[model samples]
Target: MARVVVDVMLKPEILDPQGQAVQRALPRLGFEGIADVRQGKRFELDLEGPADEAALARIREIAGTFLANTVIEDFVVRVEEPAEAASADNNAEEGAVR
Candidate 1:
């Protein structure tokens, strides 16, 4: 199984009304060291199968075609490996040292 972590953010030039409102409120609330706070979105997807070429391709297509707006927003996908893959990496390190 794979856990796909996606981050979607607005382009820098795009104005974020909600984030600006929050930024304005922070100073009144005495929260210091707060600069411009532009909010974005995070999505965690539980993928049923393995993370292979086809799966990665599908993820990119989905993000570009629907999830992320090509004009104003951009997205990045991070694929988390399965438990077995993690163990295999650990085992490889153990053997490499011996």
Candidate 2:
């Protein structure tokens, strides 16, 4: 199976109250030096086959039409490597850490 990731973010001109709230709280929680924060949404899709150009185009259309409001938001779609590859990478990292 192929994994497709869609990230939806508000336009630069749009105000993000939730993101602002998080930014404000970060200082109080002992985290600092963050200039700003913009919250966004993520959608992961598991497809039956590889993520080819056609699949990516279809996902882009879906993201623009259904996942994001084109007037106030923008979206990016990408394909992630298979879970087995990711797992192997994670295991390698763990081994290195130990």
Candidate 3:
């Protein structure tokens, strides 16, 4: 199986109140040195076949049309390697921070 990831983020000009709230709390929690934070959304899709050019194009279309708000947000779609996907799954199962 192939894993496709879609990441949706607000446009740089858009204000991110949620991200700003986290950034402000980070300092209170003793995590320092971060200049800024922008919260976003991630979508993972498992495909039955290879992630080829055609599949990528379809994914991009889906991302642009359904996954992101084109007026205020942008999205990127990518194929995730099996190893990397496995690692991320393991981390989630173990309650590790991303």
Candidate 4:
């Protein structure tokens, strides 16, 4: 088993009005030193795999095919080994059970 973490964001050249709105709001909330802020989405998944290399390869495919847009957005993917993945899955499942 493997775990995949994915992050997706708009292209650099693309403008995020929502993010800009949040940035503008920050100053009023007494938060400073943040020159700018861009917002995006996060996804977490657990996938079965044959090996670390293969898992990462599959993760890349998943990101390109469904998790991210090759056009206006970019994605980052991370794959972890079975031990790590299983532990996290167990924790998540346990939480669900509760």
Superposition TM-score, candidate 4 onto the true structure: 0.72
Q: Judged by lDDT, which candidate is best?
A: 3
Candidate 3, residues 1-98, lDDT tens digits: the string is 89999999999999999999999999999999999999999999888989999999999999998999989998989898877755665455635644
lDDT of candidate 2 at residue 42, scale 0 to 100: 96
lDDT of each: 0.81, 0.89, 0.90, 0.77
Instruction: Give each model's clash number.
Output: 0, 0, 0, 0
**lDDT for 9 (candidate 1):** 90
**Candidate 4 lDDT tens digits, 1-98:** 45577889988898988789999999999999888788888897866644377777877898899888889889988655556544555455544422
TM-score of each: 0.76, 0.83, 0.84, 0.72
- Give the per-residue lDDT of model 1 (tens digit) for 12-79: 89998888999999989999888899888888777898877888889889888888897999899888
Q: What's the lDDT of the predicted structure labeled candidate 4?
A: 0.77
Reference-based TM-score, model 1: 0.76
User: If ranked by lDDT, best first, what sequence of candidates would result?
Assistant: 3, 2, 1, 4
Task: State which candidate has the highest TM-score.
Answer: 3
In angstroms, give how far residue 37 of model 1 lies from its true place.
0.7
> For candidate 1, what is the lDDT?
0.81
**What lDDT would candidate 3 get against the real structure?**
0.90
**Candidate 4: regions farther than 4 A off:** 80-98
